[model samples]
Target: MPQQVRGVIARSKGAPVEIATVNIPDPGPGEVVVDIAACGVCHTDLTYRDGGINDEFPFLLGHEASGIVESVGEGVTSVAVGDFVVLNWRAVCGQCRACKRGRPQYCFDTHNAAQKMTLEDGTELTPALGIGAFADKTLVHAGQCTKVDPSADPAVVGLLGCGVMAGLGAAVNTGNVSRGDTVAVIGCGGVGDAAIMGARLAGAVKIIAIDRDDKKLEWAKDLGATHTINGGQVDAVEAVQELTGGFGADVVIDAVGRPETWKQAFYARDLAGTVVLVGVPTPDMTLEMPLIDFFSRGGSLKSSWYGDCLPERDFPMLVDLYQQGRLPLEKFVTERIKIDEVEAAFHRMHAGEVLRSVVVL
Candidate 1:
């Protein structure tokens, strides 16, 4: 039987999302139904609402989420009903080349629910990041649910599903930040601050945070930044160089994703240093720079996709760290909001007022 539940959806491009009746079909052979406990309001959801992601109108918004397995399809064995889990977009297919090479994190053929979730009128909805979790319940491939400690707050651990994971992975995984490394993160939003935390966890001795917003910079400091640079008042690249003994940082991460910020990240790194791009850029955005610069400055320039994370391995470990008070995951949840207040949360996010506004169901 199909269940009807209230969900937030963007019915058309560039329009406000609304609560609508959504239909969730029973899990198929490899699917499970999750009863959402909380979902974070991410910038990507707003992008979907604004038609920035694609022409996938009627998108079911919200992706960063934590929930419980309410039911499972016949073939499901990894999780049982009532298991606390963090929802992830990546459901690696073991047969894919990436998975076969033991790099399931880069799996090319991720899985989603075989059945389509529809609106009350039977119109199919495009789930955000393949895990539309802004509702009472959502259908997902069984592999999408990564079990974590049930004691942790859903609002906090849920963040590991997306932005938080992206930022942390950007520094730890992509940038290969290590002990005694000097790291600079450009952008002090949730993602940037998460990168700071990751760098700290990786034993970075000097962590410099750069941002235009003073408030977000303060937040970055709380998350373990050794110094903060006001990018609006100072040249970010020069500031980073000055802070790192006039040599720049070993790892520079651009969380802003704009070409200007990316260039700043490139120029703000020591010679042969790594630069990680974790911020997402719009499709129409373009960059033009001297080809020689890329050759002369020899180091890794990597784009971190979902923090290059494997949710199965990372989520549980992060949750354990959070439980032990080693990771300040709770700090990311700036506010708890109802699902209906998501639109306002988007405005707050755009205004740089909150780190994250989570919808607590």
Candidate 2:
């Protein structure tokens, strides 16, 4: 029998998301049904609601989710019912060319459940990032469920499902911050703060955080920034270089994807230093940096997709670290809300009042 659960849905573009009763089908082959414990209200969810991602109308909005495995469909073996898991958007398809080259982090073919969840009246619903989870339960591809330490608080651990992982991976995986390295992160949003934490964890000697908001800069300090540069008050690149012994940071991460911020990161990196772009940019955006500057910058210009994460190999280890207090995951959860509060949470986000407003089921 199908089950009806309360979920938030964006009925159409630019429309406010509303709580509704959604029908969840039985898991299909290689799929799983998750009893979601908590789901974070991320920017992507708001983007989906605004139709910024696509015209996938009536989108089921919630992706940064953690839950307990309620059941698995045929051929599912990586996890079992009752397993505690963090849901990931990218369910790596092993046969993709990237996987064949052993770079599964860039796996071209990711997956989602074949069957669709629906509104109570039978309208097909598109799950946000293929893992709509701002509900009591959700359906996803079996591979999307990454098992983690059950001892860790699910509310905090679930955040790693998206923004946190993307930011941390932006620094450690794509930016490749190392011991004694100088790092700079542009934007003090959740992702930027995570990059600062990653730099700290990697033993960076100086971590400069640049943002326009003073509250966010304070949040960045708590996360591990050695220094803060208010972009609104000064030239971000100049301040960053001044903090790093008059030389720019070895790795500069642009957490704000606008072309202007990208230029800031590009110029604020030392010669041969890497620039990691984890920020999502709009299609209207374009860059006009000189060809000579591109040639002069001798290091990698990389984009981190889902933080170059391999869920099976990473989520569990991070959860264990969180359980041991090595990672301050709890600090990221600014408030716990119900599924119905997603719209209000978006308001809070727009006002820049909180780090994360998570929906606790």
Candidate 3:
């Protein structure tokens, strides 16, 4: 039987989200129903509400979530009913070309529920990132569920589902931040701070944080940034170079996803240093720079999609690290909110007032 639950939804573009009746159908073959414990308010959710992602209106607007599996469809052996799990957008299809090449992290085909959840009126809703979770229950492919230590805070570990994972993966996976390496992260939002945490976890010697907000910079310090640069007050590239002993950081990550921030990341790295782009940019954004500089830089420039992470592998490991006191994942949850508070959380996020506001179900 389908269940009717309260959920946040963007009924139309550029409109505020509302708590409405969402119908969650029972899991079909290869699907599972999750009873969400906590769902984090992400910038991506706001983007979807603003129509930045697509014309998919009436979007069920949260994806970074942690939940308990309430039911599993036939043949679903990966996760069982009553398991605590984090929902991941990227449910790799093992037969895809990327997965066949042993790089499931870059799997070209991902999985979502084959069946649709609907409004009270039976209108189909589009799930954000294919895992709409700002509700009491959500339906997703069984592969989208990643089991983690149930002891961890749901509000905190749920972040590993999206932005936090992207930032951490940008440093540890894409940038390959290592012991004694100097790392610089541009943007001190949740993602940028996660990069700082990732660098620290990877044993980076010096971590420089760049952002316009002093509050975020302070938060960066708590996350292990060795230095902070106010991009609004100084030439961030120059400050980073000076802080890194006249060269620059070994790895510079752009978490703002703008051309200006990208250029700063490009110039803020030492010669032959890596630059990782993890921030999402709008479709109209374009980058232009000297082609010669690309050759002279002599290092990799990479874009991270979901931090190039494999949920099955990275989610459990990260949750364990968070539970052991090695990773401060809880700090990402700046506040806990009710489902109806998602719009206010979006405003807080836009005002640079909170790293994350999670809805506790």
Q: Which ten residues in a row have the lowest lDDT in candidate 2?
A: 240-249
Local lDDT at 91 for model 2: 90
Residues 280-313, candidate 3: write the lDDT tens digits: 8888999888899999779889999988899989
| Model 3 stretches astray by more than 4 angstroms | none
Measured with C-alpha atoms, the lDDT of residue 16 in candidate 1 is 80
**Model 2, runs deviating above 4 Å:** none
lDDT of each: 0.95, 0.92, 0.94
lDDT of 2 by residue, 166-207 (tens): 999899888889999999999999899999988998899889
Better of 2 and 3 by lDDT: 3
List candidate 1 segments past 4 Å from native.
none
Q: What local lDDT does model 2 show for residue 87?
A: 97
User: Could you give the candidate ranking by lDDT, starting with the highest?
Assistant: 1, 3, 2
Report the lDDT of model 1 for residue 185: 97
